[model samples]
Target: MVSPHVQDELRIFFTSLALGACMRETLAEWRPVVDEAIADLVPREIDTEYLESFFGEPTYAYDPDGLQRALSDPLWDLLDRGGKRWRAVLFLVFVEGFGEDPMAYLPYACIPEILHNGTIIVDDVEDGATKRRGEPALHHIYGRDVALNAGNALYFLPLKILTEDPGNLPAEQRLAAYEMLMDELNRTHLGQGMDICWHNEREVRITPAEYLEMCACKTGCLGRIVARLAAIITDQPERVERAAATYAELTAVAFQIGDDILDVENSLGRAGEFGKEFGNDVREGKKTLLVIHAIEESPPETATRLQEILEAETNTDDELAEALSIIEDAGSIEYAREHALELAADARAAVDELALDAETTDRLYTFTEFVVDRDV
Candidate 1:
């Protein structure tokens, strides 16, 4: 049984998760307006079948039940597994900071959630991850081919959502949003490429600077996109936008480092509770900041053993234990914690520079605190 305090935390996280569903419902309300606009713009009959084919072929033809079960059901189930909705909240918070009605940007808020879940579906396949949000990964249930198609399908939905202007955003703003979204997608994929390359190259030593850059591209880009879009919507000055992006980037770095720390610590079964296998990063040969620090600081024998553990085709429980011990003995865990704190502090300072209301600023600061202090 979970403690009352832990239950309370889960409740809060679920509440945030519900916000994404709420945004989806709100966007559904605008479908009629969007359909009418599309009807006016296009004269031909739109081929509905192509929608499913956009990502790839269906599992079976002339069997609606089979197709739905193979793709749509699994995709929706994965999304339903629930998340902290941090990205959506970040976008909404910035929208509020600009004095805009957040509800008016509900469709925009859904973009990040869609993109995030899509990435998770594909990432689980890439990492051979078994669980997500306390449920089996989409690929595990639906097969990798179907999961990949569904996940990639989700990637295009955001483009459709953004370009369709369900909220009746100005044409210029819509174009700008599309441009920003494209840039973010590019950065994310590039960063993922770097990560995949490093992991595959087991013998390659990664520097702290390289790891930070990867985090900026892979993790920080989402926050940067949200801030930039919010600024665009609010017609804020360039300087304010830059500050917002900087704050979000810093927050992302801190959050990712904290995540790496948790992967090593597996604190209180937090990783399992959060729907991930603990220490799988080690199994995957991830060159995390702690690993880098430990290798650079530990004794030659310890560092060599750590590398061998990472490079091994498979690691037993005892081997993983030894790797964790090396990290702790080298003080890399503490180093990561302190580094996350410093990043969070810099994020707060960046928020201070933004021309936002006091309440908005406080919310940003609170989120920064949550990034560094959250246990799960």
Candidate 2:
């Protein structure tokens, strides 16, 4: 949950931007169906029927209980914590943008969504995060070994489409899907590697462009996967596919920036915010756009103090609160918010330029708005 004071500030901030009032369609039309598909894809209980259907009849003896313990339990525990599931919704929106029924291509939504939850699990481990979605992080509850295996397993689970022919694509289409998924996955890993290097070694001072490029590689990945996969499923031409993917990537980048803002917001109310404890990013010495901007723009002593706080072995509430005050004084929070708003607007404009079906384009627009607006 967002901190009360910060949530009030953000509600005022977002409201001033004239963002949409609500996103009921996401819950009414999207959430139930997307979650149901996820349940069917990633099981709570492993039965012979599920295993054989997904993996075909095993040559060796299979243990249902083993899968439930090792894979399904921790996975569901994390997923059950709750996610916006926007990646799946984005895939469906892309399908409709090409004048196809999103429901017709619904099951494929699991591809990006599961990959996303996988990344969250891995991220929490890497960040040594304590909580996710208001619960102790998976690694903290389950052993690191269990969480890691479960998280890593999520990466490969969606590939079942290739062998199982769940979507019943022609051979060529299946090969294309595999290629796109691998390409984006590789890029995301590279982004994560860059992030790790920056935070782990505080001497590194990265430029704004470098940070954005990292986001383009990491969080930006799933949107491309969702949109391009939608393009594939809908049989759209290459031009359409490229356009859809570009628009979705833009939205994802904006969403990433907004999340960094939430970390600061989390600091205001408590300790960690989004991924772990409120102000956890501050504790981790994360180099978010807010940190970067404040460092560049603040008075020398203020900036130096901020950097020192971030690079500290550990921080106190006083230090964390001071760092936030420095950022706010430098206007970095509003600066981050402005950039996020611009990106969201750019994403929406890209959709408007597409000149797709009116309703389809509207859904895309609303989704993009929802991304930046939701947290506020």
Candidate 3:
């Protein structure tokens, strides 16, 4: 993971290209704000006084150091690992797009970023992944119990900010935000469940539409939360909220498809350039859009062979390499890339339905471009 000092550079620097030079530079500038928000909410160092302030002075004594070790360490370890923190930035972008001064809502911006990292810690364990951000998964370093508890803590820790109205938002707005978070969280788990079930299949049982739907749930839920939270603060009409949420959701789907492309294209290097192992998706037999499309478009024999590698009890490095070749030969990489572009267009169309200002619309367009075009 790059250090916070380097991250002061650009958040999505390694991602695919989009936006003009001016906006691109501005996007980098947006990174540190999200970073600052995350730091503010979940500091690297924790003490009893901090706990008392957050959880109230305990009726019993507070084990500050132990809680810090168990909770703060693992969460920070994962955070110190590289994440674009785009979700938090996305929250701010939408707030600005809806014509709100995003700084006023900065505290709320931390929610999705923290929750996204929480998912990563838990996801690594669920995926049985060995590496994250070029190192061992948190579970490996912290022990399963500690990692699990730490990961779970991230999920609820941000909720306290919401429930306590730390932002001093109205009671009605707080309730709306709370309900939205709960709804999206459920969708995220269901999407993860579908992902697990599909990957575990012995055959290609998932369609492109089905895969897109799963992505809408798994990856898009947090994206939706980012937009929806902004909508709440902006007090946008339902139509505007729906349009903004759709843009976020579809952009997330496009981003996931792009990442799946990298699973085959860039999987050969970078130890999961996108925070996973080399060919990690193949190793997991992840039925990514690449594999799904290859199976459908290739010759029957070729299709059968690809499935054989995926369904194998365990794949060798050679076999995974072969799988990449098979998908490439089927031209599934370009096919998937084209599909991602379509999703980005769909996302833009969602924004077009809104009457937002040109700058806001352009920024949304720029974000969609980044999602489909990113290299990792």
Candidate number achieving the greatest TM-score relative to the actual structure: 3
lDDT of 3 by residue, 125-200 (tens): 8877789999999999989899988888999998888876755788888888889899999999999999988877
- Considering every candidate listed, which one attains the maximal lDDT? 3
lDDT score for candidate 1 against the true structure = 0.74
Any residue pairs clashing in model 2, and if so which? 271-278, 271-279, 272-277, 272-278, 272-279, 273-277, 273-278
Locate the minimum summed-lDDT window of 10 residues in model 3.
10-19
**Candidate 2 residue 85 C-alpha distance from true site, Å:** 1.8
Q: Which ranges of candidate 1 are over 4 A from the true structure? A: 1-71, 267-278
Error of 1 at 105 (Å): 1.1
TM-score of each: 0.79, 0.87, 0.88
Better of 1 and 3 by TM-score: 3
Q: What is the lDDT of residue 165 in candidate 1?
A: 65
Candidate 3: regions farther than 4 A off: 1-19, 22-30, 267-279, 316-318
C-alpha RMSD of candidate 2: 7.4
Sliding window of 10 residues with minimal summed lDDT for model 2 = 10-19
Query: Cα deviation in Å at residue 278, candidate 3?
Result: 5.7
